[model samples]
Target: MPRRLVKVFARLNPRRSPEDSLALRASVLASILTAELTILAMGYYGLITTVAVPLLTAAGFYISWRRRRERNLLIKLILAVMVVAAAVIFLRELAGSLYDTRLPLIRLFLWLQVMHSFDLPARRDLKFSLVSGLILITAGAVLSISMTYIAGLALFSAAAVAALIQFQLSEDSQRVDRVVAADPWRLAAGSFLVWLMLVSVAVPVMLVMPQSTQARLTSLPVSELTKIFSDFPSEVVNPYYREGGDPFDRPPQFSADSYYGFNPYMDLRSRGRLSDDIVLKVRSDRYDFYRGIVFDVYNGKGWEMSDEEGEDIVSSSPPFELPVDTSMPRGGTSIQSFYIQADLPNIIFSGWRPVSLFFPADRIKIDKYGSLRSPYQLTDDTVYSVVTEQPLTAGSYLRRFPRAGDPAAGPEYTALPDAYGADILEIEKLTRGLTGSYDNTYDKVLAVERYLKETYPYDLEIGPQRSERDAVAYFLFEEQAGYCEHFASAMAVMLRSVGIPARVVTGYTGGSLNPFTGLWEVRQSDAHAWVEVYFGSAGWVGFDPTPGFDMPGDASRDRDNFMLSGIIDYLGGIDFGPAGRAVSAAGAWLGRGAAWLTSVPLAQLSAVATGAAALAASAGLALRRLMLRRRQSRLATAGLSRELLRDPSLKGYLRLLKRLAGIGLARRPEETLRRFARRVSLSTGSADFEELNAIIEELRYSGRPRSDGDQRRVAALSLEIDERLREGRAATGRA
Candidate 1:
């Protein structure tokens, strides 16, 4: 039909035009290459090399030749079969995606694009294919926040510009009166310029846009996606195993033995390595140990809860008031919010002596030793709050006051197994000199703490104790080296031998603070053990005997302030007054709303919130529409032509182009006016055409200041070109 179509079709004709075919193949190759980079960015390299590359290559080869040929039934049938297979896979994945719906949806979208890649026969189809590549790149952006995605985006942008420019130029090559086709080098340079312009605009917009604080959608289910892709054993994927029973039957115990620090039982002899995996993110005004579980009984080898089944507190709703008495005269209060990152047991970790726990659970349990446990297992989705009252043990008033032991808490706090009597004797002998060194109980506990810190070395990889000796005895008498657990156990046992009611408590130490989130990232390595001694009036006072460990009061305060300084520095240049005001107003409104809603039932509260959100959305939509309509009306009456003519240089250039067209000397579609004017001047023997061309080029391309004198010169040149063109036309007609 057209010359362009003939050229495109000739590529498929083996004997007709091998060069055209090769060039078309190169363009298709560039498009496919960039598409593969995008696919790799989405972490689908296996699929790219295995399916996409070969399929796209074959499709491109077939389509380049088939532009003007009749549709082949065999190819149509093959494409139909592929569509059917992809549909079946999509349905299967959709049905199986019970754990995460997004994974299956993304996979199905990818499959559809892959199937469509083979059927790209027309120029429109090729454009659609490139658009599909863009869609996949967007999916990759949604799936990853890594720097690799940025690199992929950059590469894809460059390749896409090149392919689109080449495609447009090739299509236009068939049109009548079109100028010389763009060379490959010119096309590549234009693509580079386009990419640079896009990046220049995009970066500023990205910097100014509000950053989201929500967890990334892609990172949320990455582990689950990895499981689907990896070649791991079935047992590793599905951890439930049946023993001599129906395979469908549930296992006897939910094995959490893999998480070393969180297990209910702790064997001191077995020194297992800890992972750096983050387990908890906490936001609180003060820093303190995130107490998980406490073990009152210490057998010779390990620590265990004396009673595995704790007493459950009966409650109809949440905000469970723990049995801990926070009304003590010397108690200091703090509020904490926790977000769990990893799957953990149904234990609620908070600062020492939690007074009130607010969660979505129906019932909660507390052991006799002040350890809080949840009614259900907690995973990454679990978020809860705790209101804790830490005793003001650091204060001068509490340290000076000599409080008697609580007889009610006597047996549980001071209880030690009879089998460890040798350990008790050794503890007493070792602490004999320090027993009478302090008159007050606080001073006595401090002395014991000082002794452990000064005498012992902290070693995570301590050797196993002898069969005859208890772990405490070995750590205190012979080894003189161990981790937090050993130091805490030794101090507690030594205090108990001297009639002080002390017990070892297990929990996480203060974690590293994240400046961006204002949350403490508590890793598995932060797991620690410390001693809590019972004081009659002041309640249980926490004391860490670990060598490098600092008390939560001073250490946490300093660290929190340091992290806050970093946050301030990060936001140094940004104006936050409006944002701060908005946040404060939102907080105040939420506080008031919560206070009012607390009296209402939870079901009603949820309904009210949903209704309120819908109403607000509707109002916002109506307001936006009204504003848009008003803006359009204003623009319609504003005289856009008059506004454009306000610039004298642009006005003069337009007038000159219009005057030239009136004389039947109009510029060609692909020709620059400067070149057109030079040709015209040679034919007409007029210098005015060249002069006018120079003035127009300067005003358009040079980006220089145009004065009144330049404007007057442009008007004079335009008149002279018009007169010369008229005279030349008359002379030609007369000849």
Candidate 2:
């Protein structure tokens, strides 16, 4: 057998070798192609500026030039540098990508590859470069799972095959004196075919593998996604500006004034358009607008609302009555629940005096101010059910309040830095004038709210106008047309001036309701702010001073922008485009209306559809087989015999092997005829094994056509093998 194999190889090419020039050419081409793929993957055109690409090109040219061939070192070097430079710029642009920003790492790998590209003195360097390229492509896969990544996978596989061919070509080059053979295209095409076959088999195995068994990793670099509202319960210097608009069109942008942790980064001052609909959903029996950090003192630019240790206030729970008057009537309602998920934070946006809040799972914590909080960064959709009560009357609570005696309420709320513009006293005066007397706090709040709604008109173009000297005052007195913040701020300050206690509340309001699911969907456009009036009988009455604006739970706003809802619909094969509409129409025509399907319980419908599909497939396959059999019967048997008997007699032998496998031993494609026989021999009982050998020998050596009688004997042998396996199993069980 070994001698026969040697003869076959010798007949083909005992002394033939590929030339050095051809081998060198293959390496150079591979390097260049590899660089091109890297550039395409990174999506940056300025890679030519980097030294890496040039270095690689030079290395390739030098090797070629040293043998007296014309090669340009400078051109090679320039290409390498440009490719690397382009890659860097591409990565730099993805500073905010959470997972798909590994392009920089790929650039570094590509540069190393370019630097070593031309120096392919040893086959090892060339092989290593190709391998590194494959690694770079694989890394890119971690960024995205799409058709583009599949293309990269194909490219990587093809490269691997090419590398193998290069190794073979290089070996042939070293022995060129004997005989010459070179065909780069043929080698590359062969490698690609082999790679494709390997991948076809690998795909099934990969799908079977559990995702958890593989690495759970993110490709985002040093900078991670940062939360905007982390300093929960912190004082805000909120001189409210206009708020409320479409979140999808433009949303509010929040950034820390200073760096918090180790990650060093800055923001470009930009603001998103306000969302008119409330993004949050409160299911509490009691009504309250969800609240976040509150700023007591305004510094012209922003508000300072900190609930730090020194700023913490005493709680006002029942048993241990607050130092303030308990005689003040409290609102009867209790246990208000809220389901809120927004682009904003988990800092609760609720009525001022919240008694308790029911959180999703155990995610809620509280700051010293009794403000609800989140366990970690709030990214996913959240459902918060809070329990709260409002004061019944605003008048009684304002009198002889604990903080009322103290001139400075708290450092965070009172402190005015040097940078702060002087508008505090003016705001106070206007607030006092709006609310006539401290005894009628609710009346004062209403007066202030009415003034804002009557005075300023709602507009998004106020930011630039309000950026001038005395912007808030200008916005309240002069501009006449501003957004929610401008109106809400004016209202809050006016209420405070009359000693009718009040605070500016910023949160989402009036949400859009999804007709499909009957759930309020909040979008980026739902971000909003309104005034919370102090009522002694009720803790804090939630109110919106924006003239035409409805209070929370009024249920007038549209809410269809859940972050993942859109993405989930996409993954689940729900399309809203023209193609999707066509598909929907077709489905309806086929008695599979989209509405009906959506109405069905997801699990039950999926099960029923799967079963129906399986039945249909089985029926179709049976029909196809019956039709094929009928066609076969109409054909002449003699012609079938002629075609089978013409050459090789390989078909009969293959059928025999399959029959043998059906019982016990099976043959692998990679195995030789002899190896298959050896495995058959090991099976206990010689009934079918002996008979099989007789047939193989007759077919191989004798080259004789088996008679009908002989064919029957082979069939009998196949059945005997089946019996042997059955008997073996029986014996094992009986023992």
Superposed on all Cα atoms, the candidates' RMSDs to the truth, in angstroms, are 17.0, 17.8
> For every model shown, what is its TM-score relative to the native structure?
0.48, 0.36
Candidate 2: tens digits of C-alpha lDDT, residues 1-735: 977865664565323221345454455455456544644544332545354464556656466435333233444456567667766766675543323345555555656565555444444545566666666665655433223556556665666666666666566445411112355577667677767756765553342221210122322122122233333333222212222342213333443321110011111112335434334443333223445544455444433344422222222211111123345445553443344343444354555556544333222345544444543434334434344455443335444332333332333322433442356567677777666564444556666767777776787654454344443566666666666666666565555544555555566543433322223344445455666654434444556777668664442222222222322332234335786676665544533333344445656755765676577668768976887444333221112234344434334444544444434344443445555555555544353565565665565567686777766666666566556555664221110
Give the runs in model 1 whose Cα sits over 4 Å from its true position.
Answer: 1-265, 314-317, 324-326, 330-332, 404-408, 417-422, 556-735
Top candidate, metric lDDT: 1
515-573, model 1: which lDDT tens digit per residue?
44545678767778888887667667789999989777764244212222333333342
Compared with the true structure, model 2 gives a TM-score of 0.36
User: Candidate 2: which stretches are off by over 4 Å?
Assistant: 1-351, 354-457, 463-478, 490-503, 506-529, 546-656, 670-675, 704-735
Q: What lDDT does each candidate get? A: 0.61, 0.47
